[model samples]
Structure formats: C-alpha cells, structure tokens
Target chain A: MRDHLAFRLAYRGTAFKGFQFQKNVVTIQAKVEEAFARYFKESRRVHFGSRTDAGVHAYDHFVYFPKAFELYTALGVSKRKSFLSSLNFMLGNDIRIWEFGRLSSNFNVMEDIVSKSYSYFILSSPVEDPILTEYFHWIRHSLNLRAMRKAQRQILGTHNFACFAKSSGVSVRNSERGTTRRIYKASIVSRLHPQMKIGQILEFKFEGSGFLRHMVRNMVGTLVQVGEGKGTNIKSILRSGSRLEAGPNLPANSLFLTGTKIRAGLYAPLRPQTE
Target chain B: MRDHLAFRLAYRGTAFKGFQFQKNVVTIQAKVEEAFARYFKESRRVHFGSRTDAGVHAYDHFVYFPKAFELYTALGVSKRKSFLSSLNFMLGNDIRIWEFGRLSSNFNVMEDIVSKSYSYFILSSPVEDPILTEYFHWIRHSLNLRAMRKAQRQILGTHNFACFAKSSGVSVRNSERGTTRRIYKASIVSRLHPQMKIGQILEFKFEGSGFLRHMVRNMVGTLVQVGEGKGTNIKSILRSGSRLEAGPNLPANSLFLTGTKIRAGLYAPLRPQTE
Candidate 1:
C-alpha cells in the first residue's frame, strides 16, 4: 500500500448523505472510495479531517490516502490518469479536488493539532434570492445583529459544551468523549450590499480547537434565539450545562467548513488568511 | 387592467425553458403570468425589457405587469402581501421580484431609451469547480486575454453587427430587424484570487445601447476565438457584415444581464460600476 498522500477537497453537500460511509445510501466517502477503486485499481479506506453532517458544505475538507499515493508514484510512467485529474474525473459533479500533495507518513488528518473555521449564512428577510437559495438559509424575520454579537462573546472560551450537542440516541460514550472544547473566536458580520434591496445576508463565523456533533448548529440556533430577543441570559445557559436550555439546532445546509489551520510544515496553507 | 407598474426581477434560468410565454412549455413569463392570475384574480400580458434564452440568468430583468399594480392598490388593505411580496410568494423558488414601483403611464419596458449590461464568466482550466459548475462556462485550454481585448475594441462603436448575430433558419426578418446596435463599453476582467490553485475566472462585460438576438453570445464566441488565436482579422469580419464570418454563438448559461442603465429619473442604480 502507498503511504503519505493528503488531499484538500471541496464539495457541495446537498446530494450526499454525509461524509461517512453508509450501507445502501450514497455518501461522500463511498463515492470517493469507489472512484479510487475504479480509477487507481485499488481499494484503500480514506480518512477525513472532520465528519460533516448532511447538507453541510466544506471548502477545505482534507483526506489522507496511504495507498493512493503509492499508486500515483508507481503509475507516473503512464499519462492516462494522473493522480488529481483522474480522481476528479471519476468523482461526480458535486465533489472537487482542489489540491493534493505528499505528506509525512506521520501525518494524520484527524489527530493533527490545529484549528478549523466554520461559517453559517443566514438571509434575513422575506424576500428571496432564488439563484442563491441553496447557499443561504433564508429566515423571514429580521435578526438583531448586536444581540447576536454579544451572545457570541459570552461563549468564546473553554467550557463544557454539553448543552450544545445532540443526544446520539445510542451508547452515550461517543457523545461524552470530548465535551469540553475551546472556542478561539466567534463573531457575526453582515455581507449585505446596497444593491441588495429586500434582505441582508448575515454570516456567523466560529473558529475553535475542535467541534462536537451538532455543536456548531446548536450554538447558531442559540445565537439566533438571542438575536430574535428570545434568549436574554446566554451565560446561564452555558452555566447550566444542559442541552434543553439551549435553542434548537440550525439547519445544516447553510453551514460551511471555510478553512482549516494545520501544523506548520505539514502542508502549505491553501490561502492567506485575511482575518 | 392597471397601467403603470414596473418590476425589477431576477431568476436562475436553469429550470425554465426561456423568458417568453409558450403554449405548453414551462417559461418565466408563463410562471409570472400564472402567479398574477392566482394571486390577483386577473391575467395580464407581461412585457419584458429583454428576451432571454434558456439557462440565461439575469441580475436585473425588468418587466411591466399592468394588472399587478392594480391588484396591489385595489387590495391595499393588507400590508402582508403588498404588491411585491404577494407576487413573490406565488412564484416558484427559481424566480424573485427584487423591486417594484409605479411608473409613468407612457413608460414601456421594451421601448425605453437606455442601455443594458451583460457579463459572461469563463473558468479557464481543466479542473472543474463542482459548486460553480452551473454558473461558469468552463474552457479547458488557455485563452489569450490580450488578443480578446483587442478584438473587443474593434467591435466597440456604432456598427452594423450583422456578422455577430445568429440567423434564424425560418425567416430572414428575424435576423435583419434592428441589426444596427451601439456598443457603449466592452472590457475583459480577471476575477482570479490568490487562493485559486488551478483555474482563472475571466469576466467579459458588454454594455450596449441595444442588442440583437444572440448578439452578446455571438460576440463572446468570436472573442473566444480571437483569444484562441483562431481569428485575427476581426475588423475584416465586421467590414464584411456577414454572420458566417463571425465565430459560433456561446451557450446561454454563462451570460448574465448584470443591470440596465435607464433614464436618470426612472429607477435607482442597482450597484456601483467598478470600471
């Protein structure tokens, strides 16, 4: 088996079930692994940096394939299907491989100590942008940006975020494995332009050491409640450490994994961070 | 029927057949007319400022609906479905009405003395962006931007652009009427970002006093040829005034009617022009 290959990819998450493999339903991992078997004539499992929910887009999703790298190097003599091009060609219309490179054999996409950033987009107004419906979450009522900003500040530190996660409805060990996660940064910004007459697009960004299942969505839902003037005491909710105290979880369609900051010298940063 | 109503609208044209009304086909005009009939209990013939082909998006497509305004004013008791919101609620997810206003009784959408702007996006790379596949016209080979710029300048002034129009096979009048059009501004811009690893997005903008059928698409097709080093004597093609001399017409998906520059008192400008 080949070793030491990392791929930076992006996909529109509307079509697949999620990042994980499934039995009968289609998923991102299934499609990608099938592509590998078909194009490279090998079947190796792929490891993802983060497990995304259904309908959550990722602009910087990472994957590690040990045997795929060896297949690329060994097939260098043939020009039929180079590593990146061949895989991209075989994948469906919703997934794209942006960059690929050789990494240290020790590199692990899941356990790498770094940060990741996610953004949730909300279109606030009754007016609809038909062309952008898939990209934005349309909320008919106006949201209080000032209140949401204050709520974001209240949750920007190390805390036992048990309340922000959903119950797995199975064995509870998976949900309790890592409940104490750190929030490095959290803010809400408006991306509205003057030409946009009817509504405004508010982008909420969260950067953290790690995230729990549905944690970001639940936080966004709570922040939205604060913006709606429904939740006044956000610190109490955090202090309560109760999932019932938090607001409902937001939909996954509007969430995006925008960037991932990995350790130095592992791989080149995809783009310069403006913020 | 109410007389003085103008609507500024936009739609993602991937679903509809075209802008015009047809007997059995699903079209933007038919949808809008159906919405008016359903919401206002009246059917009125809608006139569009421009006729768009299938899969052509519009940022600011204007339409004049005579009965829609009457319905709003007559049913002015309810603020909930006011004029714009009522129609928007009735329309499908692929269409949106951005703005509506009362106009002069003599104002006509097709006869207005103004200019229109169009933008065509080209993703010049072999690798595809799955998220952006529906929006951009992907070209695998490298294009000569300098050569295309030169070709754009040659077709800029008042000219008989018969050479750059698609000929309707059935009748000659379809291609002959209003063939003389004025080109106000023409330029090619690069929307490339530092983070983009593989492809470059080139935006071609064309502002003209008027356009013939398929004029913009034909011009884009010819410019692409010049960029590909296939067409050098573009001035001769213009001098010849023959449709056979120009390149083929491009697809409709990549073209967008960015905005229209109407009379100063007609409507508000949608966005600031960077150039």
Candidate 2:
C-alpha cells in the first residue's frame, strides 16, 4: 500500500548551492535527506510539490515521502512519524521543515496543488536598499507603479506559459515542455517594510493552477522592464508564447512562493479578493 | 621622497581562506597584487582600511596602491582606473571600490576614524518572519526594549571596552586589554518591514569612536535576553562594568555599519532640523 507524507520547507539559498539535490555539492535536499537517512536504514526517496532553483527560497514547499520514518526511537509505527520533527531540529537553521502531515497514497504534491501563488518583489528607492538586497530586486531608478499595474492586467488569464518558464530551473528538459496555466489572480501591491527607512516598494502577486519553468520570474522581469518604459506591446509579448520576447530574467532574490496549490480538504476555496 | 600609489583590491572570501595575507592560503591582498603584477610588470602591495573576517561580506572595500600608474594603453591603465566603478559589478556586487584618493602617508583606516558604527539585525516574529529570515537573526521571543535601553546607556561613556569583545575577535592576552570607546549615540530601534505581516522588530543602532571585539554583538545578545525577560537583574546587568554579566551574542546578520565617522572632507553635515 502506498502512503504519503506532506511537508512544508523554507530555506536560505545564499549559502546553499541550490535546492535540487546534488551528489557532490551541499544542497537543501541533500541536507534534509542526509538527516532523514540517519533515521532509516534504507534510503527513501522524497517527491516534492515544487522545485526551486539555486538562490531561490520557498515559504512553502510540499513533499510526499513513503510512510516516512528515517529518524526515530523504536516505539510503534506512530512514533516513527513524530521523528520527523526531531529530525528537523537537528537539521539546523539554514534548512527548516516547519509542518508535516500524512497525505493520501494518491496525493501528489505537484498534481494535487490547486494553485501556486508567487510574489515578485520590486524595491523602489533613490539609493540601493540594503535590507531587500537579498529578498527583492532593487531598482535605483524611479518605478512607475501605475505603469507596472497597467501592464500587469494583460498577463492574467488562461495562456500558454512557455514564454515565462523558458529558463526551466535545474531540470531544463521539463521546463522546455511548456505549460498551460490559468491565472486566477494578478496585481501590483505597494507597502512600506516596517524595518526599513526611506521605504518605497511595488510587489506583484499572482496565482495560477500551475506554472511553467521560470514563468513567474519572466513575467515580473518583463513587467519591470515595462514599468521602466523599456518594453513595447506587452500584450503581444504575452501572446507570443516565446521566451525570447519576454526579455531578461531578473534576480531570484526578489521572487518568493508565498503559498501553494492545495487540494480541497482543509482550506476554504480562495476566490479572487475583488470578486 | 615616498610617492603614494592608490590601489583597488578585490577578493572572494570563500576562494581565499581568510582576509589577511598569509603564506599558505589565498588572500584578497594576494589576488589584487597578482592582478597588479600583470598590469604593471612589477610587484605591488596594497593596504586596507579594515580587515574583514573569513566569511564576512563587503559591498565597498578600499585599498591604497603605493604609486599611481597609467599602465600601457593597450594593456589598459586609464580603463582599469576608471574600472574602479566596475568594482560594483558581479561578485563585486558584494565588494566594491568607489573612489581613489591620495591621502597623507600617516592616514590609517583603524587609527584615524572619527567614529565607527555597526547595526545588529534581529527578525522578531510570531511565526518566524520569512521576509527577514536571510538578512538578520530570527528572534522568536519578544525583546525588552526598556531593559535594552538601560543597558545601552551604561556603555556610552569612554571606558575600556575590552570586556565587551571576545578572545577570538580582539585576540588579546587579557580580555580587558583593548581600546576605550566613546559612544556618540545608542538607541533601540524597531520598524515594520514592508512585507513582514507580523512581528515586533527593533534595530539597535550605535555610533562610537571605535568598537571592541564583538562588543556590539555581545551587547545586542544581552539586550535580547533582557528584552525576552529571560535574564533578570536588569539594573545590575546594565551598571555592572564586567562583560561576564552581558547577554549572549546574537547572530551577526542583525548588525550593520549604517554610517561611518566621516572626515572633514567627506562630511557635509546637514543643518539642524527647524523646529
């Protein structure tokens, strides 16, 4: 019988080589799996709901393990599951596993997720913002939020997301396949970070049933170009479905996955805020 | 007669074992000298304003080359000097050289400073703040600002700060053998980060003629304990002249050098705010 384990992960990518597991290099997966391996005699594979690239951090990353129990005292079958928490504690600060639960055998993190929401942070300031240097893309030039929002609307809806995901993270082949996604929400948000001074910012949050490779990064990067008044015909760029037309890929520091696509079990159905 | 040649130095800490030039490990100074050897066809030496630790990062680092040069045009002298601006480029993002100036041979970064300041950051949140995670330490518990302020005041006067530094940081036979510092100002500051939804945060800022080894970190760590009510005897903790009673060292992420003591030439002091 197949059993599933769900997990939530967050990591800091500056010191890590990347999120994807590498045999020789120190990576998020390797670190986590190394701890898990110590608990179990046999190595168990972990399937992830999403994959983030080098230097990309995740607020939520779901993974399903097969009735996982790598680290534990020989209590009963039940105590094995509890060991995950203990394992997390030993894993240290750079990589963390905050929440865990059992998933149905058929539950697939990638397929079952109802929607994935991503945040593209753009920091607007006359001087380079020190705090956001790692969290958001800092643009020293003035940003026209109005223009960014105006261009944002053209991107929301059902479309071939191949143009955005062309960078394809680590698994280049999968990203090249392209994707069909429905954008449930999209908008530009502004706020002042509590810890910052001389603060001004613009954030792009979008939700979709699924995303293509690097899709969020490209969309935000293009929008930033559009915000800077550098790109022309963003609507055509969205429709072109070609990665080249989207322009350059921005830094991963400013991109964040705020939430994940969850199957309807615990969370209420999230509709568009305005609607 | 001695001629001062200004040199720009750049090095990756991880690439080298440490910052200081050593015979065994690669150092930033060694690399810069290598580059100079290629350019000048002669060996050159560089001097730094401060020596950063092994893992530390520097966005702007200035080094002086004893003699100025317009290396062969084809080999590129003017371009390389102007390339000083290029220091902010690439891995240089973490290291840079803004400008070069001929200073009196007597000038020194350590001895000639008017005042030196650094900030220590802490991410205080109900649920760990994902936004502030990378750049600062995560303090899950609440901090006692009142107690912290009281403790901060005790360190303001020009007193021997040796007790504040650690053996590793200052490396003295006697822990108390160090510089006496005058704290121009000390404050407990907290602000809302733009993206952080929940948390209490304060950045402790202090400006002083100089700093003891790990003094700011040790001070902030103790303040955190006081803020969280974990440590009692707040009065004695502040008034006691010994570092033994101070709090533990918070992570280095919380600290920053917001501003430096500028020389008369670099100073363009603003007029007092009109009431």
Candidate 3:
C-alpha cells in the first residue's frame, strides 16, 4: 500500500520563473523537487493543483506526491511538524510549507478542486511606490471604480471565456471542453495604502469553478479600460468570442492566488497534528 | 543672492549603500547629486537632516541645497510640479520627492532639528517570510512583549548613550559633544501582520532630540535580549559606557526614519505650491 502526502504552501513569486517544470530556468516545481531529492534521496513526481504564471504569487496553493514512509522513519521525522520544517529548510525563504498531511493513495490534487480565488492589486497613482513595486501594478492616473465595478458584474456566472484566453493555435471548436467557465464571484474594492498616503490600492477579486489561461488578467485589463472611460463593451466582447475584442493582459506580478477549495476537504485541518 | 530649495523625500533603502556620498559605491546622496547634475548640468552639494546608514528606509527625511532657479527656467520647468516630476524621473523609483519648496538660505537642515522619529520592524516566527525579507528582521522564537515594554521605559529622558555608539577610537573626553542625548518617546507595539497570519510584527518606535551612531539598532538589540529573558541590565550598560555591554546591533534593513521635526518648521507646510 502506497501512502501519499499533500502540502498547502505560500510563495512570493518574484524570484521564480513560474510553478511549472521547465528546462534551465528556476521554477517553483523544480525547487520543490530539488529539495525533495536532497532530503529523501529519491526522485519523485509532484502534481500541483494549478500552474500559476511567472511572477504570480500565491497565498494558498496545493501540491501532492507519493510519500516514502520508510524514508521518513529513517530521517526521524516522527511528526508532520518535523517533516514540514525539514522540507522548508531545504526549500529556502521564498516558499513556505504551511501544512502537510498523509493522504489516501488515490487522492488527486488537481481533480478534487471545487473553487479558486485570485486577487489582483493595482496602485492607482502618478508614481510607483518603491516598497510596493514588486507586488502592485502602478497606473499613472486614478481609475473609475464605479465603472470598473459595473463591468465586474458582467463576469459573474457561466460564460464562454474564449475571448479572454491566450490563443494556443488550437481552435475552440476542436477543443473538447471549450472555454466555458463558471465565475462564482467578481468584485473590486479600493483602500488606502498603509505606507503610501498619496495613492489608493485597488483589489480585484474573483472566485470561480475554473478559469481559462490568461482569463483573469485579460478580464482585469478590460475592466481597467472601462475604468479609464474607454467605452469598452464587455458584454459584446464576451459575445464576440474574439481575443482581439478583449483588453491586453495585465502583468502577472500583481496577481495572487489567494485560496482554493477542494472536494476532499484538504484545507479543513488548519492546524497540523503535533503527534 | 542665492535661492535655496528644501525637499522632503521618502526612500526604500534596499539598493542604497547609505545616505552619505562615497567614492566608487552607490549611495542616496550620490544618486541625488547625479540626478541634479544631469538635470541642471551643475554640481551642487546637498545637506541632509540625518545621515542614515545603508539598508535603512526613510518615509520622511529632509535635504536642502542652493536652488538653480535659472536652470529650472532653462529646462522649461516653470512650475514646482514640473520640477519635481522631472527630477523624480531622473532619481528613478527608489527615491521620491514628496514635497519641495523655496527655503531661506539661512535655514540649516541639520542644526535646526528638534526631533527625529525612527521605526524598526521585527517578525517573530519560526521561519522568515520571503515577501517581507527586505523590510523586517525575523526572530525564530516568540518574544516577551511585556518585558520589552518594561525595558522601553528606561530609554526615555536624558541619558548617556555612549555604550550604544559605534566606537571611532575617539574617546568621549576628546569629543566636542558628549554622547548625552534626550529621548522623548520609546515604545514597542505588536500587531497582526496584514499578509502573514502566522507571525506578529513588532514595531519599536523611538523619538529623540538626537541619536548617536548605531544608537537605535543597539537599543533594539538590547531590548530583544531582554525580551528573550536574558535579563540584560540596560541601566548598567549605559553606566559602563561600553559597547560590548549592549546587545548586538540589529540589521539595518528593518529600521526606518519615520519623521523628523525641524526647529525651522521645515515640515509646517504640508502642501507644495502648484505655482
């Protein structure tokens, strides 16, 4: 009987290429595999819940792999706390293992997803703040929040998001699943920055059953244009199903994967067992 | 007759070596002077209210220099707003000139100082946070907040801070001004971090008539030892006037020059004139 382990982690994506495995570039997956190889002295493949883009941060995310129980015994990791600490020590400061536990061998990290929440931060000001440069996208002018919110309302419920996705040369007609996705919630809010007095930070939050590649970013870009009084017709853009009708994709640095829910109740146990 | 200009600026000190000008290395003063030279085509020396160390951020600080009013006209910077925007473009994103105005030539930025406020941030957690790595010092264990506050009370009022000063081989007897200084306020507060849920960010704030070299960092280091139940006698350390008796100087990255009050009322005018 093979035992599996699941991990919920957070990472600052400034130093990583992305969460995917690639050749010759530093990535989150590569680092995790490297740490596992160094600690367990065995090669193992890990599956991620989502493949986040380059420079996209994550406050809550998931990964799972087969656990070598004998290796844990040999390494004296009797508790989940020891296992997390030892793996984190090898993973460096950029990524943190927030929680980990034993899972059934048949548990699938990717297929069990129920919902995903993402947050995009925007600093609306004439000048960029040095301290927040890595985490916020700076705009030179103030945005029309009312208009953006009005546009956000159109994103709720199921819609064919082919227009918002990056074209992969595969026609939507030929794709089995197509580009339809259910957006559970979409909203925007502006708040005073704690450090910068002159600017407001706008948070664009979205929760959905699933999203197409570049969907959230493209939607935000379109809403930003609406906020700028560009007179963008988001409804028509969705109806047209043309990528050209959507606004440009925003930068990934300001985007964050805030939360994810799984059918297996992976995040239900907030506190790891000490024993 | 020479017109003087005064600027209130904020900076994130990650890329700067220090505020003072030095040869062959990057410093805040060096960057400012370079920007001035590039824009005005002249070399001008700037006087800073406080000379902050490398990796120390400042939200409110002062600098003054003789204004090249003629150069502003020559460069088509007719308004103060234009002057600021143009200069900031040259200074890059690390430093921002928040306010600038005409100052009396006799106004001395350094000697007219009434008070200076500094804030130091510490994150007490088992592991370091990657996002806050540039701005906070991470401690592995929980600190005794009550004990730290108790130690903070001893720092108020006039005291000889010679022990906290970095020794320059010049004895106190040979110095023109002794290390005696007046501290108006010393406080420690712990608050939940906005992003990181696992750790509490402790803020140590100090306000004084003046501070000696390495004074704030040294004081914080000693307070940390006391919080760790080291039973550090701050009174004895001050009385001995020995650097070795105090705690180790904390890292500069976590320290910030929050504000400065000038006897000349440099900060009295909150808004800069558009004309």
Backbone clashes in model 1, listed as residue pairs: A2-A66, A2-A67
Q: Candidate 3's error at B233, in angstroms?
A: 3.0
Poorest lDDT segment (10 consecutive residues) of candidate 2 chain A: A266-275
Q: Which candidate should be chosen as best, given lDDT against the real structure?
A: 3
lDDT of 3 by residue, B131-186 (tens): 77789998867888999998889988999898898763235674445788889999
Per-model TM-score, in order, reads 0.89, 0.65, 0.89
The DockQ-based order of candidates, best leading, equals 1, 3, 2
DockQ of 1: 0.36
lDDT of 2 by residue, B130-219 (tens): 445545677655666777787677667776664566643354543333445678888877865343334556778778876665677887
* Full-model lDDT for every candidate: 0.76, 0.61, 0.79
- DockQ of predictions, in order shown: 0.36, 0.05, 0.30
Off by over 4 Å in 3: A1-3, A67-81, A104-106, A168-177, A264-275, B1-3, B67-81, B168-177, B263-275
DockQ of candidate 2 is 0.05
Residue B8 accuracy (lDDT) in model 2: 30
Best by DockQ: 1
Ranking of predictions according to TM-score: 1, 3, 2
